[model samples]
Target chain A: MSGLSKKQESLIKSLYTRHGRKKHNLCICEGLRCCYEVLNLNPQLVEIAVCSEDFDLSTLPAVASEINFIRVPQEKMKSFSSTVASQGVLVVAAKPEFSKSDDAPADPYIFVLDRVMDPGNFGTILRTAKSVGLTELWFTAGSVDAFNDKVIRSAMGAQFGMTLREFSDLDVLAEELRRFGYNRIFRTTPHEGESCFTAPDLFEKTAIIIGNEANGAAELDGSLSLTIPMPGNYESINAAQAATVILFEYVRRSEGGA
Target chain B: MSGLSKKQESLIKSLYTRHGRKKHNLCICEGLRCCYEVLNLNPQLVEIAVCSEDFDLSTLPAVASEINFIRVPQEKMKSFSSTVASQGVLVVAAKPEFSKSDDAPADPYIFVLDRVMDPGNFGTILRTAKSVGLTELWFTAGSVDAFNDKVIRSAMGAQFGMTLREFSDLDVLAEELRRFGYNRIFRTTPHEGESCFTAPDLFEKTAIIIGNEANGAAELDGSLSLTIPMPGNYESINAAQAATVILFEYVRRSEGGA
Candidate 1:
């Protein structure tokens, strides 16, 4: 019952060879949750691809009619799957603009990563940031490709309305965020003078910069906390975990009306 | 200069398989930092392999003399390497006895993962736990093999002198730790009850059970916490990150003298 067109197959295959994400500002979203999320949000989804014959259309909202589901072979699905598991569903969605909107809080808090190498870490951070109402995130050189298939799967569908921009020269992003008045930036560190719990809360105009896996941020110098861990055997936690602990604390403080 | 004996080649290649890690109880440590870290502790090294003739060994500690040096074909070294970039160094070192040595804290705190999947996350968390002196880490059935190359690399040579046990059934572990009087076994969750810091500070025979990537540990209904963020954008950090945050907090309370 699959009705995949050769033309569509060629299109996505062409996408694999090119930096379609960097060039076109889009990435592929796979599986049930991500598709459902984008469907619920009614965003600009380029197309939906399905390999199963019994693909359900009823669970989706009426706007789902607008979603294009081209059929493809399961083999092709395996080849295209970013996740180790193929959930038999896929969509190509426009990368959301992290740029703040009027309905979004007037003072937007942002998260930025510099060359975080793991896709799972990247996705988990995105999922948490979205839950906490982060409006935008910018990636600097050395970060993983956000649209990477592994990232799509690991994000657990948080990419639906997320906005992201990758800058080849990350050092320049500080000036750019400043243009948007996101000048109060905080960097997350396991080593820091202040505990993550009591660090200054995220103001409306804040940008949180996370660092590389091994090295701290290449450009980060004067972060609020330089050493957070106790003198102990464990030198540092995973970078993504460090970011999550600090991010959640920021959100907690924000929620408490800090 | 290529003097890799057939026996040496087989031994190193055996490490590529799981049987190798189990049979020899040794893992391959590659790159300059790991090689030196192994040397610093003066581990029972199997041998040292170098791909380049120009690699300077003058500054390495005198303990390195006991290490057998085998120069392999450069192309093969590149093939076996976990990292693409190379300083032309690799060593196979015995997995130090992870049992609670006198070095182990008397309180005997442990960290647990239900089903952590990523090698990097597992490695990073293992490193964090090791840093915090939580050397007694036992893995549930579905967790990744602790001795995998990526995990070894990510642990940053911290795997030394650590105990990791894989139980065929978590029931045995749950029963065992329970018998051991870990009355305060807890799990970390953003959705649940107590904050980690506020949750009765734990010491002496404690276990922190972290869950899988998609599902945090199963709701054993007894030990859970209010999930929190990293004070960054992520609503959740990757499993590695989550484990790091939780494990280090345990470290801080136990070792931080806070």
Candidate 2:
């Protein structure tokens, strides 16, 4: 939580340090939706901090048995939080263990992003990816951390119930997916050839690859290539948007052609 | 423009205001790509603020032109910006103008949003819309201000050299588009008529209506008369992603089955 106070400043600065946050094993969620969604999805919240007096908490899920709530502490709370207005609630919860084995669904529709650097893009893609029937997500080769504050807020807790995978190469996983008959790979570009709308037809088992914002692709070493259908002045879509379109195309296809 | 000081608070606050930003006629791009792309696009940048004493701007465009360089008076600059650590460069420029009417292209591939509240999603949509032939954009009554700081930063300058219409009504515009021979209209939903991928052969005139984040098209009277393409999940694609996929389908059809 943040407030307009010196004490709040010290607490927040302390929270910024990994050792401090890790010791508590808790991080903050400042935005409304991220905080609310996490509360809805995870029944393990230890405590919550609300900085704005106008916040209504009666609707939130029951807190863990021993937990108690903290008041916004008036002008002091804003200093502990990042968003300008604080959105009425700021939460501190023990970070959930993100396990690929546990969180990855029985049949997963996942988003695979590579070297995507923009936090906002990363966040927006998560929001979009989730809306499109994606229940799992992975990042590789220098993509921004999903736990990064902006990503967590942007994902709207979509990540809360999903498995997140991080690795440089997923040859083993790809092979496994292939064995499960889920390995039709698609790459996005504005260049000619296969259009993304047709992507759903290629595989019930599919992986959509979106590259860095600036560099389209480093190598397609072991992936099938596809491009979104673009007919415009710009040559490419931003990484997140491209990923969202392809992922949804697969979902739409799986839904029997939406 | 924000940095910490006894006084940079007002400067940071200025960022949240359209009038204040316009009075100064300058806006800031906080992220790496927003800065790099501004340099790559060469859009009349006034200066690049570098914070560290050892920071270098040598490889950026037109280093010869003498960018108004400043090694951050560190404390004040950090107070003036949004990011945790200042990248040092916040390009300040007169907000670009979208003429709306000019030597506009003969026929425009455009996407219109009714009211998308999320700035990041709005930006991603603009980015994707641009990539997929939407060179002109219109925001209907419920839409957030397109030039608001969040939206602009989100757009990543995709609006550079393009036109935008604000507070317009789809009913009036759709009627006008019909006069121009753009009669095809498509809507997106999770339970609906065709699959977004294969339906509505997109060779002719088309206008896609993407509703807001919540209760899409509910606020806009009569827009629901339009047919929607249903997809896999019970939930629909995020509005922006829905727009991107639907717009691209048009492009695929126009390509003569290539």
Candidate 3:
């Protein structure tokens, strides 16, 4: 295996920023689990896989052989890593592209995020969205970058399995949703809305909007508001946790359970 | 308003570690939200409140006048903060203490955590637990320190409002649960066991076990296993997300909806 060249090193460092990732059309997936995930599930998008000298090659999947592998010293790998403890492996892959024209036939549910700035919350929401069988995610303009390394790590590689779409304006997103036959648009509020458990038609032609961590969703014209009843009367739960509860309620309802 | 003393500065820095927190019987709450939380909700616990010179005093709760408030330079405040962007306010409070004798009468629900190592997950779980009206939490020995700054930030100061109990062994925890009349002990699993929605008696005299993020719960003898049905058939949702779904299901059932 060859060592990473100076050009490659600079590129890997640049992957940490949104402008750089956009400029190169590439994102970095660090740690052994993410690297393995990209290799196993989306190998075609991977351009290079870098491993520290001590990293075991046998543990890699068969698809690793088809990709360009670079061996670097442990110290060098640490420098390129975003995590406190580097797992000795990293992968640079093309950002999966999804356009407005790529909608699946009769897709009933979509999770729309508006200005969700926290990386951990954004990533956790992605992981939950994927768990609930969502094939695509929509984000408003002010949301954190989907390809951020912290988001990637928190998501545990869910980005590999889902399509992400960004909309510059909420009005435009609402228009597109209506055009796609999503008749029910729901926004979560801390209080004073339909109880999520009893909210009808959550799994049918629905788009649930999870708002920003602090400010919450921008008012969507004609959108129904839903609230998860907090008997404890606490102000709110974590944004990601709230999204998970609502999404899984969709799962619970779809499974024909109460 | 006086600047922090050298000894006080050293103590605040040490509060970042479990050892130091234990030694001082104190924990640090950084950022304006958390500091305000401790000040407003648990005022007696606040030992010292520190803020950058430019921090607005009018925004603080009325109780701020009862505590020692220190004014420091913005740069100095940053030096003592654990977050990327300090909110210009930090509070050092005595860690809330709870013991075996403090169990609430007829308390039917308890969330037990087994070796949950991720600070973000632990904190998110704490936030969800509080939202579900849970007043106490139990943790296995290997779990992350509940007072760690990252945990505090993710929990959004939920720690100030709940009681925490840590056990040296799962057996001891189970025994404690039984003594408290918690007959139904449920451990979450990625697969198998009863579906959370259909699980009988989840809200009646129940204790739910959330496992470690990676390896999951260590086998608890006689514990019933429960699973969140994933329609997407993804490997699993995030641990915090899973806990949220299950906890809110408790809310749903109690509300007589599901």
Candidate 4:
């Protein structure tokens, strides 16, 4: 109670909300593993909050000593944590800034996430896309905030490394990316699309659109679509699972010498 | 207050635990959607529990009328539910019986889940396995129970349609499957394994082993391992996401005709 003041506590709590995160320009990373990743990446890290009695800062990486941090009681960490489970370590960092890069490839393969509401699904998609070597990620306005704590936990630090772009209108963003030489913007659909296994010319510059959890993607005029051929009668797979299949298919087609 | 007897409430809650489910030889299906799936699948559906006031029995399929059911007040339903967000509908069904048919084909591609713990990840693997035309699913001991409420929700009803077998010891299970004519047992690993993209003879009677969340699969002597080539520096992808990529790759290789 004496270590973290009421003002600091309120500030930490505010970061859980989109409005507060935007106003303060901060992102909160919880759990020891994720905090370790943030410290290792060393990307605009502000401070780390830890349980005063139980947590030993020396156990963390050497870079952790270079950053500003605070120690609070275990109960305080629990009270401020947005997740159901807290790992007693929370890192406050300035959100990685988003901007168009000059060195970005002319015909890059980007991922356009459309209104993916679930934080876990959004985070998994980020991790999967990054694993497949996707350098750039874009999202529509309605999707979950990329910096949300749950998303950061699920993403496992890909959010820190990838170049991210947020757009208010997808129609405008599609046109801009197409002009920048992103040739294909394929909206993933559960049906009425070409099978990814047999689709031709998959090596071209592409932007695969991953949709919302329940509603799927918004209709984008003139855009192509792709489907993972499902042999069973199950209604649908999870959004993250679907995105993983599509992203890997892109990689397979591009690199398999097909 | 008298709508749902105390006996019924306790009975429903008991199914939440693995011991209770095993003793009763039943599984609990939570949420309206999952309950509907259980009714439609008609896989030994025992009974359905509904909120007394708001639930309309007629909205369910005609086959629902053929099953035993009970109606309880909304609060009673809440008390019996295991999930944080209960949908006020629960169904009790017999545990799906597992057996290898005598007429089974010589070469069958199976998914051997070795100690996958996360319910959400386990469920996603089930749905993906089913989507890719895999009918036989085997789980080694120490994995999360397949009928768990979280697994049931994430699986989106795949559990109702698949043939699931739980084995106490994986070594024994592997030997049995081998004797049953499963020629290849490929354990999925993160490194130093055959690349799925260029791997030959993928269509053979194969069983892909997906490992645990934290630790990879237990090393099985003489089992082949397959790796998904990752171009990034990230540690690894989610267990279910990795499994999905691998499952779809098998589909692509065997059927794509590339």
Candidate 5:
């Protein structure tokens, strides 16, 4: 069994913070499932794989062989874990670099998260976006760090399959979207604008904006606002739930339903 | 300002547990939004309202005057709080009594949660169900308690507007659903059965089952299965996200959209 050096331990601990992750250009993927995903889907980004003595190495993917592996006592592994109950495995990997080129794809369907602060909500959005076949996600600067431990855990390794980009300003993002041939920029309101279901050409070259938990989306110039048509008395659903509903609507429409 | 009695303090602490909630036939509604909701939507259920000295009574609804109001120091209120930061207010109220009679409604849309263990997921599902105009939800006995503190917080007081009921067994629930004219019983799989969007007559007299986070739905005889198609490599989205997508589809279709 390999032991973690003091320097390695320090590095792993630092990854819990956004500043540290940015400094090292690495993020921690904790739990067995997340570690497996980082190793299986994007093995090239993985720098180190650490597991407790009881964790079965045979269960890991074949690509895990190429990565540096560290084995330690269960108690030691738990110290490095962010979750209350560690799954006995963790991985440190370089953050994926999404393309920032000016070229726009023929059919762009993007999810732009504007100041979504909740880690769980952000993570669920990433997971939902991936499930609906989205390749990339754009976030405003104020949104929670994509690599936050809680976000990563809730995302369930959906991050490995997604290209995440961040923008400092909504107007800048709007300008860029238009440049990329995204003709329809949709933002959801509690009750305003056209109903999402009845909105014409919703799936074609679209960029949908999901806002923060406490506040709706930040105002973007030239963006078409749409509502989910909440018939119930409550003001609105949570941001993550709202995002999932809208994304799946795209899926439904793309599949020739309705 | 009225201080909490020793008996009242003990009761408030005990309400944190499921057994205590059952024994007292009451649940705690914490935070400003939730307290506001319980008071506004279902004031009759409110037995006692407790607040920190700093909480402004003027902001509360006119109905607040009818309930027993107790005031305590912020530090004292924090001691009884289940959350890290109490929004300075809490409400102890009787659990809403949903109808148990045999009569079938003319048109019914029910959410059947089977062993959903995550409080956050349960709460989000409740919020989504309410947003889509659902008046009630049914749960299999093994599911997490509807009145769990985390569930209440995450649900953002949607419980006040919802009729919650429980069935000890999936079979009994299925039989009851049939008796209630729920002809189309749908449970989601990762990828199987009919696509949720294309499922014919999905919204008419339907009971959609949301399963546990780890294990899928409990098998019920004669229930039709449906899936939200995921083109991504991930196995599945979280239970709450999946439920929202499916429920909103009901909203979309009912509003004459695909």
Candidate 6:
């Protein structure tokens, strides 16, 4: 019986590395649910691999018909997994490319991440950004690879719903955001700054930078440094939690007439 | 080369189980940062376990002087650990006990977790609740053990800063909150009811219920079920993310002059 080709397996595994993903122009989306989700939303998927034991051909989404569907032994499928709990389905999809010239949507909000190391946090930020209708997200060089298996899983397939770009440097990213007509760059911090609750407006063309888990976006020289105004003295919030607070604040201001 | 006794090791490991934690009235705080933090905040810690290889006695927190500090072999320490990446220090501390009659602080806000299964999410919620100045968190029986090693590590020592109560049942928990004078129970849901941005007075004497990762707070009979109001077609925010958004919104309303 024909098995998953060596080239295909290598491509899926290569998504674990930035170099591999960039070279192949492909990233792996794993878990049966995420595969179906990404495939449904973005039919740009090249192929999907499923364990024969868990394969239910009848439940495969319509988009799966448009892409190569390969079956592998249940035991063999584990080797290709990036997660501890593999759902036995993996999708190989083309990386959605975004550049400086990509047109911004009406009232665009961009999320910039600087050296966020935790794959779970990175993915949750991506999912939260997508939930708030953020069309674009940029990460500086030191940030974790967004296409890493853990991140892809944590993102819950939000990667397929938005534009993701990794810049080599913050200065380069700042220039790119400026080119894209972002008028404000708000760097999220836990320290002294304008309270996010009282910030003038987040509805305009803006880029929000959320920093690393330990040391925040100290490197980013954004136009405004926004703080969440934590009165509790219980230490600062986590990166992803802070990001969601700000993301939904944008949603609140835009929709609730704050 | 005598190290942690069998009793001490057993106590630390017991925190991984709800029954064990409750029986001993103790919980484990793992990792270098959280161990030091919990020790400094609670000072009720009974002991500290450090791997001899990673031990820097000079860097130990001032509170360590009041407790037993044992040095174990690195390999032995791993056996006692619940985390994949233990930082070689774990604090055995008394759990902060709360009951129905525990006095609420002025304008007290309580966080209720119905059946949050994910330890990481539960821990993040605890950290967020602490960060927002919520001194009390109530968890019904089915939620993940708050003192589980993963929750303790994920909480980053915030567990020591707040009062944690695991109620045997939601009805009992609800009755207890009412006795504590919480006028409203705001259940967090991803679906529609009331926009949190437009909801009336989340900063008052309130208890916010964050539910399981999948089913949400369907069990809570809150005065109002609050939604984040996602303008995008994205499915829903993660449990912890939704809780943080609501928690900070309460902060914003209270501190930012709503």
Interface RMSD of each: 5.4, 3.7, 1.1, 1.8, 1.1, 1.6
DockQ for all models: 0.31, 0.40, 0.86, 0.63, 0.79, 0.70
Query: lDDT tens string, model 2, B1-258?
Result: 333343334554575676767676666665445555666554565433344344456645564245554555656556656656665555555566656543333444346677788786687777766666655776777677565656766676666645676645667666555666656755444465455555544434565667778766533333323333433232344576667666655665565432
Model 6 scores a TM of 0.90
Worst ten-residue run, lDDT, model 2 chain A?
Answer: A101-110
Global fold similarity of model 1 (TM-score) = 0.81
Q: Could you give candidate 6's per-residue lDDT for residues A191-257 as a string of tens digits?
A: 8778888877665778888988888875656578888888778668889999998888887777753
Which candidate should be chosen as best, given DockQ against the real structure?
Answer: 3
| Tens digits of per-residue lDDT for model 3, B1-258 | 557999999999999989999899999998877777777678899887899988887787888877778999999999988788889999888987665465553446888899999998899899888878888889999999999988988787889988888999788988888887887899999998999998878879889999998899889899998999998777787788888998999899988875
Pick the winner on lDDT between candidates 2 and 4.
4
Chain B TM-score, one value per candidate, order as shown: 0.83, 0.76, 0.96, 0.90, 0.95, 0.87
B1-258 in candidate 1: lDDT tens per residue? 558767777787788677998898877887776666667654565444454555667555577666666665567677777676766878877777655422433446657888888787787777777766654677887787777777877777766656676666556666666766665677766566666554555555667777787778766645645454434343355576556556655644543322
- Our tally of clashes for model 2 stands at 25
Model 1 misses residue B95 by how many Å? 2.7
DockQ for candidate 3, C-alpha atoms: 0.86
Model 5 residue B64 CA deviation (Å) reads 2.3
Kindly report which residue pairs in candidate 3 clash with one another.
none
Measured by TM-score, the strongest candidate is 3
Candidate 6: list runs displaced more than 4 Å: A1-23, A55-60, A65-68, A99-107, A220-222, B5-25, B57-60, B73-84, B99-107, B220-223
For candidate 1, write residues A4-121 as lDDT tens digits.
6676565555454337666766567778776666676645655644544446766555666665676566677877765667777777666665654323333356678988988877
Residues B1-258, model 4: lDDT tens digits: 245666766767788888888888877887777777777776455554555567776766677777556767677777777766667677777777665544353325777899999999998898888777777678889999998878987776678877887787679778877877776888878886887777777557777788998888998888888888787657789999989988888777666536
**Model 4: chain B TM-score relative to the native chain B:** 0.90
The local lDDT score (0 to 100) that residue A162 gets in candidate 4 is 76
Residues A8-125 of candidate 5: C-alpha lDDT, one tens digit per residue: 8999999999999989999999997787777777889887778998888777788777777898999999999988899999998888877656645433577889999999999999
Tens digits of lDDT, candidate 5, B151-200: 98888778887778788978888888888778789998898899988988
Which ranges of candidate 4 are over 4 A from the true structure?
A: A56-60, A82-85, A100-107, B1-3, B56-60, B65-75, B82-84, B100-107
* Selected candidate, larger lDDT, 4 vs 5: 5
